[model samples]
Structures are given as structure tokens and as C-alpha cells.
Target: MSKSVPSFLQNELSGSVMTMYSGDYGGVEVQGNIQFSINYVQKLREFHIFVAQCRDLAAVDPKRGRSDPYVKSYLVPDKAKIGKRKTSVKKKTLNPIFNELLRYRLRMEHLRTQTLILSVWHHDTFGRNSFLGEVDVDLSKWDFDHTQMNYLALKSRPTSSLQPSDDRGEMKLAIRFLPQVSHSPGKDPPSNKGEVHIWVKDCKNLPLIRGATINPYVKCFVLPDMSRKSRQKTRVLRSTVEPVFNHTMVYDGFRQEDLKEACVELTVWDRDKLASNLLGGLRLGPGTGRSYGALVNWMDSNADEVALWERMMTSPNEWVEDVLPLRMLTTAKTVMK
Candidate 1:
């Protein structure tokens, strides 16, 4: 079955904005022997495969177990409903295709020594096209100024053995990756079979509309956030992210008690302009803007009630025993124990 243009979204592409940028790879051939670059193709393919994985996600029960998992939230048709909100969700078990998406999104959001736009592009000094974005201080490049970085920095491991067995019992190639430490080089060395998997969900039988690609699922795990109160005391904090790949996510890992005890602490910084030398320099986009506003709003809401705030502003305390509320002392002790 050849994939047809989605009838629901066909009108979205009718206007001049849509037409000016040819979405198809072949249609937008330009000078410098550049079509869409390999990086773009890889991202496009991963996104498409994500859609294909949801086909299975839609068929299963999300709450039952980890069977067809994919980070299905973003793919939730903008109109669909989950709970009280119109959010994207699919019913399925642990699907690798979706899991990879979740891992990357979480990793990108958490590791922020600096910020970068993942999907945006830029042109080169030689008049060639390029991806435009910045890397974290951990990652360096000579083209930091001219080249904008895409969100996807790590190259995916490619091979047939990477794909997991699909809904139809067909085994495909797919690869799974762990976040790299700073010392690891750009080129990732391959591992043994089943270490990674890929499931290209494109049916050759279908016509050449955009085909869906599926990713292979490896394991279900949590990314831990480590915080240190002092040089002596360290805390291993765990946050529960609703799995992006699998929307019908319900697990015992995060309990009602955890929810009751969990509260995010915000630190609001006044907006500061970027240095002229830096690319795009300290501009706030939607994420930073919202974060800034949210921090300000929270401070505004609780400015007077929060104790130790004014004192801390004047002096950084070495021994911090005075900040606790009487109500939370018991609860805090129980939690720590």
C-alpha cells in the first residue's frame, strides 16, 4: 500500500510558505551538489519511522505493560485527547523506535551547560548550505561561528542488525545508543549483534509517498539527576518522564508519594543580552522565555513567604540548618531514610 498524502493536512501545504520550501528531498536540489544533507535525511527518517512505530502503538494497551513503546506524545495528532487535554498518545508496548526519541529529547533538555537549536539550519561562508546551531562546551568545532548546529549531534549507529522484530514478526535492522561522555570521539565504533537494532517500517509494496520508519527498543530505564547540597552531602534525584515513545505509560517506579513530595525549585534570572561576538548571543526563544516567565511568576507568587531567601541574597550561608519548616521536618527525615 503506497502511502498517500495525509488528507487531513494536505491543505497545510497549499500556501506559498509551504511551496517555497520544497519538503521533498529530490525536489529541492540546489548548487554545491547539495540536496538535503545526510544529517537532515537521518532526522527525517527517524521522524518518519517514529510515525510507523505508532501504528503498533495505536493497536495495543499502554497501561498493560511495556510492549509497544515509542515516545508517542509528540506524534499524538494535535487534535487527539489524552486525559483532560487534547494531547497525543498511543496504546502500545515498548517500541524501540519511540524509546530512542524519548532518550534524545530528555538528554537534550537536561544537559545544558549551553543551549542550541537542534532542527534549525544555516549557510556556510563558501555559500554552501549547512546546519546552524551551537554545541555545548563539552563539544567543540572550528565552524562554531559559521555553522549552526542541529539538535542531533551524535551520529546514529547504522546496520541491519539494529532493528528489532516488528509487529508482523519481521526482524529489521536498528541501533540503540547511550549518551557519550566527553572523551568519546565523533565516530562511534560498532558493537556486537543485537546491541542496536533498526526497524524501517516502510513497505516496499506501498507507493513512494513519505514512508514511515520504526526504531528498535532496547531497555526501559530512567535518567538520574544528581545534585549536591554541599561537598559532603550528595543526592541522587530521579525524575519520571512520561515515556515519549509509549504514551499509555503507567509504571510503579514513580509513586503517589513521590508526586506529593516532589516540588521543583526555581531560580529566576533577569534577562541578559548576549555578547556581540557569540552567535545569536543570549536571545531567549520560547523555551527560555517560558522558563524565565515561569520563574518570575513563581517568585512573584511566593516572594514574601519564602524564608532564607533575603538572607541568602546578602550572605551565602555555610551551615544551612535554619531554612526548614516544622511541617516538613518529619516528612524530610522519612524520605531521606
Candidate 2:
């Protein structure tokens, strides 16, 4: 079907209207549209998107005959780098109201070439999920500094595979490094070693599982060697999206030079009876070569992460506290074991 450009968007487009599709489930057709808001916070260098609601969705259920729909969104071209974000599934409803916020850490220059992709899906419990429809918007054309609300029409999936977004949640932390140096004139200088104090403060906007809240915890590790000895965790908070840790861990016995290569990794996990699920993680360190000071370079394009690294390197003796936004691992290999 030919897509119709909304009158409000006509001025934004030069001469061609963007193509969109109506969602079709088996033979049952429905007119679907998504309502959302977008804004970029300059101080944080992040894009915040709120998926408010989706209406007139196609029913894709086979046995019960009602759809359990959820919305997944991501930035195009570098979908693998930014990861994907998703809303909770609303059971047996064609009109699902998510009201969920997703965030992406990106620079203003990088936003000029990026596109936003939002997809709706039918989540099946007993079988594989089915894709209902999607919407792609050229973010470069939009004014991100000013908040904008959009009612976008849904279309068929642009590609076969979908990359998940980084809407899971975020962690708050305070990192301090104390160098082992002698103050007394006569006393021998202490060994070339220091202590790293890490405080896992809290978490926010965690994802839901099976319509219930998660038991969230923070896991900390000193990287290069993510061995069992270096791993420490906070007590799991029961049934809450916003979890308060306020726990501190100290890593001693390492030269001041270790700051150049060593990094502190903090991961959030949902504590399950059998196996815990990885929610997201944050990495802090010094930039090496072309790599962004943290998390494999590609993930640390935001100003905050790079600034934190600069502070640590330039002022190793002073304490630094930063509210580091957490992001999901782009690939399975990046997941914290």
C-alpha cells in the first residue's frame, strides 16, 4: 500500500513522502500507528525517547486469537553499536500503552546521519515471536534540541533481523582512586600501589519479566582479568525496578600505572532461581589509542564517559562521582560472565 505523509510532516520532506505499511496478521488487517516523544539532553549528550502508546495493532495469536504486543526501537546504520530498547508486552490488547522511556548516548555530530527504527511485535510464550510492523524516521531532519511528539504509521519490517535497544536501565556510581604515596619526609615512600573504591549507589527504570518486576543486583569487576576473585555483588533487592545498593567495594594492591590499562566494570543482573539474566553494564577507564576510554570504544561515544576517563587520568588522587548510564551488551561475547 502507498504511504500517506501526514500534513504536519509535509514541510519536513522535500518532495517525496516516506513509505509506510499497514500491519497484517495472517489475513486480519489493521491500521497501526505509534505515538512517541523525542528529546536530546545536551548536558548528558543523550537522546531520550518515550514510547507512549500503540493503537490499531494487528492480532497475531494462533490459539487464543489475541495478540501480546510490545514495541522495540533502535537507531539505524549502527544498530549493533547502540543496541535496542523495548517496551513491556501488553497481553490481549490491540492498543498497548507502554509509556516507557529509552535513552541513547550519542553526540550531536553523530545524530546528523542517524535514523530511528521502531518495530512492533507479537510476543508468543510457547513459540517464537512474530513481527507486526515497523516505522523508520530520519532523525537528522528532526530538531532534537526541542522536544517533538510524533504519531508515526507502522510498516512491514525493513529487514529480517532486529537489533535490540539499550532501554534496560542505568546504574549510579562513585569511583575514587587513592595512590600509595608517603607524606612524611623521613619515612620511606610507600610501594607504587593504590586502592580503588567503588560505590554502587542505585539503579533506575529496569525492564520487566513475565509481567512482574525483577530482583536486581549490581556486580562489580576489575577488568583485564575478570576472574572470580575480582567479582563482587550487592544484595538483590526484591521486586523493584529502582534498586538501592549503596554498597562499596575496594580493590587494593596495584601500581598507579594500572590506571592506564585497568578498568572498573559494573553490571546489573536479575537474580533468578536458576540462572541470572544480564540487564546491562558500565565501564570506566582511560582511553587507549583510538579507543574511547571505556567499553570497547564504540559504546563510549557520549561525552560523560569520555570526560570521566579524563578526570581519572588527569587527577588520580581526587575522588570522582558520576551517574554512569548503563547499556546492554551489543553482542553475546560482550556480556559479563
Candidate 3:
């Protein structure tokens, strides 16, 4: 006898597989299914997901009396191994809460074919890590622009493994481009050459450290020249998520035409005694408004960054402001460029 499927599942899997097995034939019994959905947002330039938390996790370390768990997520069809992210380790716990956000710079047309893979793992100090369970979600089935929180029951890791959360915080930015216009002898211009001014205002909803606020800072880069001289960073704000750095960085010798070939990349990082952890980053260029041409890594095309630069070149006098949400830095292949 065929079991009746739920209306929602029936509608979604209309032409797909829908089956039940009989125990008399030695078929395996289905105990339960995981129930989790991602809260996703499609921005003009990127796809964002907020991985809230996991509940009722299965115990993978019963021998040790408890388990230290963390969540690893990835976006599938990533042959280059670029779309992967991990949450901070939560020690000795069954239910791990990871209020973390993940992002990918994918085209809208290609988004429907993507799949999101989330797995829970048991971390070990001296030995290999253990995989507890996993979940796979189809990006095409998710509703865009709305927040959906789901509780997924742990499931066995699938045989064919592929790959890969949301807004924990937001940052405000102000940008202005000054052109080099000739003026009268008596009246002096602001300077001889042009300049680009960037102001890193403040951030909100930053993740906490040990129940206390985090010391955050902003780093700016004018790519494809990532040299030390081309990079600028703000002073680390002590013990606060919302740090106001009305700080302004002036890039001298900035030409109006440079906007056509150049981009501004801002990344947020948490200050630590040893090594700072990247919080999130934003990239702005002419390509941002029209195409993602300049957004691709320069090494991929074996060409200069100027060849693909495209959007903000037309309006030099107009000041633009962007409210960017910060997401965790994932795989090196994804964020290195």
C-alpha cells in the first residue's frame, strides 16, 4: 500500500520520487527526517544565509561523556572548492547555537541550480574530527527576501557528498570621489591631484566574544594592487561592536578614470593578540552596478583589473552610501581574491 504524502511535499515533488517500503520484503524503516530551511536573501551582488542554530543533535562522543560540536556549511556545484564556511566551535554540547552568516557572490541566473550543504561535526583535539550528521537544501525551493528559521533533525551523511547563513550584523559606508579641476591662481583647489575619500561609520549586531563585546576594525584595499602601500586600515575600537570611526582615508593621485578600472574592498576583522579573524567584507566597483566583470579574480582572466571595470565612472560629484551586511570569510579560494 502507498502512503499518502504531505500536500507541501506532494506539490514540491510532483514529478519526483515519492515512495514507501514494506517491512515484509526486508525494506529498511524510515525513522525520521530532518526539518530545516535556510533564511536567505538575494542581494544585488551576493547571496546571503543566516545559519541560526542546531537542536536535538545526536551524541557522537558518548565515550568521552560529551561532544564538542561545530557547524560546517558549503554551496554545491563548487568544483573549484570555493564555497565553504564554518562556524566557531562550541565546546562540550549537544545543541550548538551558531548565530552565523554566510555569503557567496553568485549570479542570479545561476542561483537556482545551487545546493546548500550543512553538516555538524564533532571536534577532537588530538585526533581526526568526526562527522555527526548532515543536511542538504535545494536553493531553488527557498523563498527569497523572507526570513525562515527551521529546526532540522540530524540525518546520516549522504553517500554522494557535495558542498556548503545570514545577517548577524550590518555596516554603513560613505564614499566620495574628488576630481582634479583646474582653478584660478588666487583660488587654490583642494589639492593638485584627485582623491577618493572613504569613511567607515559603524557596525551593528556583531558577534560576541566570551559574553563580552568584540574589538572590531575595518581594512580597506584598492584592488588589484593589494600591496601594503595600497591598503589602509582603521584603528581597532576597543570592546564594542558599534565602533564609530568617522575616520576618512584619502587615496592621493586618484584619477576620475580610475573608477572605471578600480574597486574599493572593505573588510571587517576582530582584533586578537595572535591573529585577527575576518568578520566580513564588501567590494565596490563599476561592475557592481551593471555586471560582475571586475568582481572576478584578476588571475582567472590573466588580465588587468581595468579590462573588466564598469558602474561608478559616470558620476564623480555624486556621493554614494552603502549599508553592507558583514558575513564570515569562507574558503580561501572564495575570499583570497
Candidates in order, TM-scores: namely 0.14, 0.52, 0.46
Superior candidate under lDDT, 1 versus 3 = 3
Question: What tens-digit string does per-residue lDDT give for candidate 2 at 113-231?
Answer: 77888888877543345677778878889876667678988876555443434355566777777777554757877756677788888887666654466898988766554456888
lDDT of 3: 0.56
What Cα-based lDDT does every candidate model obtain?
0.18, 0.66, 0.56
Q: Which ten residues in a row have the lowest lDDT in candidate 1?
A: 276-285
List, residue by residue over 1-337, the lDDT tens digit for candidate 1: 0122112221111100000111112212111111111111233222111112221112122256332221211111111111000112222332222212211122221222222211112211122122211112221222323323232232212221221111111111111212112224566552211111111111111111122322222111110111232011111111111102211111122222222111222111111133111000010111111121122111111111122323322232121112110110111111222
Scanning candidate 2 in windows of ten residues, the lowest lDDT window is 10-19
**Model 3, 306: alpha-carbon shift in Å?**
14
State the lDDT of candidate 3 residue by residue for 81-149, as single tens digits.
233456677887776677877666666657777787777676654433566677777788866655666
Q: Rank by lDDT, descending?
A: 2, 3, 1
Higher TM-score: candidate 1 or 2? Answer: 2
* Model 1 regions more than 4 Å off: 1-215, 223-247, 253-337
- How badly does each model clash, as a count of residue pairs? 46, 6, 12
The TM-score-based order of candidates, best leading, equals 2, 3, 1
